[model samples]
Target: MATHHKADQPTLRSLTKRQWIRIASVVAVVGLVVAGGAATRSIYSHANAAPTAEPTAYSISDAHAASRGNARDALEGEPTYVNVTINGKTRTVLGTNFTDVKSVLDAGDITLESGDTVEPSLKTKVDESTTITISRAGAKMETEESKIPFNTVKKETSSLPKGTEKVETEGQEGILEKTNLVERSGDKIISSNTFASWVKKAPVEKVILVGTAEQQPQTTTDTSNNSSSSNSNANNNAQSASNNVGTTAPVGEMQQWAHDYLLANGGTEADFTATVYIISHESGWSVSATNPGSGAYGLPQALPGSKMASHGADWATNYQTQLKWFWDYCKSRYGSVQGAYSFWQANHWY
Candidate 1:
């Protein structure tokens, strides 16, 4: 009977609906307070946080001082590539932060020579990527005088044997020079060339005695005896000396043929040395001198070789024919041996 009374006093199922609403309201209030506190704490934390870092400053200038500092920093900090022109060639290299323009070139293995010039000096610093150019040195020139071989002249006199002559004086020589040699520093023969007829002189011709004449008294008897004796021995002696004189080295048939050819072809002793000089240089008294490089043949080294035949069909063996060709060539080209020799000196060919 007693247990039944206590159950009736505190039974939840028996509690009123208004009482349940009050409990639910209290629980909602507590939850809102806790949530507001959490939101406030998050806002405070965000406001008090530290800020991020900023970027470094960079500058470029033409001035040496600022550019130097900037260039140094750039090189030390990071690798930047730059372009440089050296020795007429373009080169690219990585510029260090502390690297000046000169040092950069050095690192690139660009060395300056005596005549070489660079746009930027060693003290110049580059703040940014840059291009440096180097100009190579040009050729050097030199002048010199050189003695050259000239023509040989021959002369005949009554006091000497037939076909004999002597070189009165040595042939004249001249000088030639070349200019502008291209080479590196301390190099020789950079460029070379011959100067034009700087000076010219007439070459002296050779002379000699060919024969002698005998003078006789005006008496009839003496004159008759002298004339008879002269014919008898002179004829035989002349015949014997003919073969010998023709083959003689300096005063041989060649010299005689040259003399006859020149006199007949409007040439004089004054121009003799000039003519001989050219022929000697070309053929050296050899009828068979031929140019293997250009196919020039004969004493004159005629390009076609057949051109000499125009003087005479016997140009191959007849000195007169060769001399004729030479005379014509001289008149048409140089007017004389001296003129021709002058041209040869400058050009090495005429």
Candidate 2:
């Protein structure tokens, strides 16, 4: 029983048309689902992948290089050179980036004291090759006391004996005050000037009085015998009379001449009084008057006696010549006889 039957093959005509369309649609739908699943898996994998960074205009390397360059420039910066003068001395200093005059001085360790001065001003800007000046000033006041000498004046008086002098008033010194302005540089003084001066005390003048009068002659008699006594008496009386007459004559003549001369020469009664006073004290109105100590001569007591020679050759003997010289002397030295008398009153001499 080996029978070989042929297997039946299926054909399109074995299904209805509606059934075939339904089967074809089911197949298309399954294929579309499979393709959509594959596309979705690819998109999900791309979204999950790591991203790459974008390039920038400036990099970290460039920033680091710029920072290093700035540091190098700061180290290589040039220093500012400045000249500074303090008092009278000048010196050079080096500074870096100093803004003002005060900062520049601070860089040099210079200090400013009260009353100190700066040429460019402390707030002024400083630069390379800038010059600055400083000055120091000081002032001090001091008081000093000093003495002023007094002057001595002399006068004549006929009330006392000749060649005698008496101090009428004592001399006194005076005081003065002075104020000065001083300029200095360091320890040296440049200049000093007197600003003010005043007298603290007024001086007192000295007064002195001189004496003038003629001395009387003395008479001596011998008592050895009566006859000798009589003769000595007569001779002594005659000599006394003669001496009295002679002494009076010269004085009267001198007084008359002085009065006439002074009155005729624009002189007043006061001047005549002063002239008589001085002449009486100086020479006792003697034409031949001479100073034993100084060789002074004449009524005016002309020193060296030769000074009167200019007036007259008979200055040693003539009363009128001595009087004329005396007038000239009074005019030249004291301006007037009254002035000479005032001087003589203070100094006991004219």
Candidate 3:
């Protein structure tokens, strides 16, 4: 009843412009914070940290090239600087503007020729430190190895009573060298001849020489009872000299030949040490060197004792005959007795 009296509520109106402005301001601040956060994240991504790498351990100490600084680079478009490797380690360089291969080389003070081939051509873009092999072009003749030729070396021997030459050693030759090779390219050989010398094809034949193969007959007697044995030997030797001119020599005479030849040449006390080896090898100082199987005889291993007779009629027992042959062999075959001795030092049979 009393409620309707004089009091009436005012009609409600819409939000004010100031209130809408305040709400818009809050939304703008939120949006700004979100955008700022995104921008910060992008900056962090662009600022990527570089990874760590190992350091090289190398040193240089010299006058000409050793004094130069160590330089290396991780190249991209162009190599900034040249790289020098030392002691299996790498270093770094900076501040260079080399563009092409030739330019880079030029900066490094390298020169090239027309026929020379570079690993990377001059027109190519330079990226990293590259190697270039410079080979000079020229014509030349050379020697090289080639295949051995087929050969058949036949032999005949009178030593065998069968009267037939037999092969001693069947040998296959091997190539030694190729010489005067013709060049086709710059300094390379296109074709060449095999200037090879064939190996000695002396057959190692088992010869059956026709001679006294049996041991020389000997009679053992008491030294006290043998009064004229030496004289008997002398007479027998003299008789042998008169008849068998090809194969008879006194042992004492052979020794004398060796001694005389050594003295006449350059035999010295030091050489005597070496001579001992020679004397021990060839007939044990016996001038009558004889290989009953091969029919080699005489002081210097003549093919047959008969051949020594060419030296003189007394070639069989004469010291001078043996000395001449031995001296000639030493001088012609070997430069000197000392040279022969050096060979003997290495080869016990020399």
Ordered list by TM-score, greatest first: 1, 2, 3
lDDT of 3 at 51: 41
Candidate 3's residue-wise lDDT over 1-350, tens digit each?
56553345432345577878988999999999999999999988777756433222111110122100122221223324433221222222222465666665454323454554555556776544543333334423454444332223222222233444344445343332223324366565564322111111211212222222234457676666566886686576445432221211112444444545566766653343333334334433334433322223344433333344556877656656855655455556567545555664454333
Better of 2 and 3 by lDDT: 2
- Compose the digit string of candidate 1's lDDT tens values, residues 108-194: 434566766777777787744456766666633343444434433334333344455544455454332222223535655543322
Error of 2 at 169 (Å): 20
- TM-score to true structure, per model: 0.29, 0.29, 0.25
lDDT of each: 0.48, 0.56, 0.40
The worst-scoring run of ten residues by lDDT in candidate 1 lies at: 59-68
Residues 104-202 of candidate 2: C-alpha lDDT, one tens digit per residue: 676554566667689999889887556888765663334455664554545555444689977766868665444443456788877543322333453
lDDT of 1: 0.48
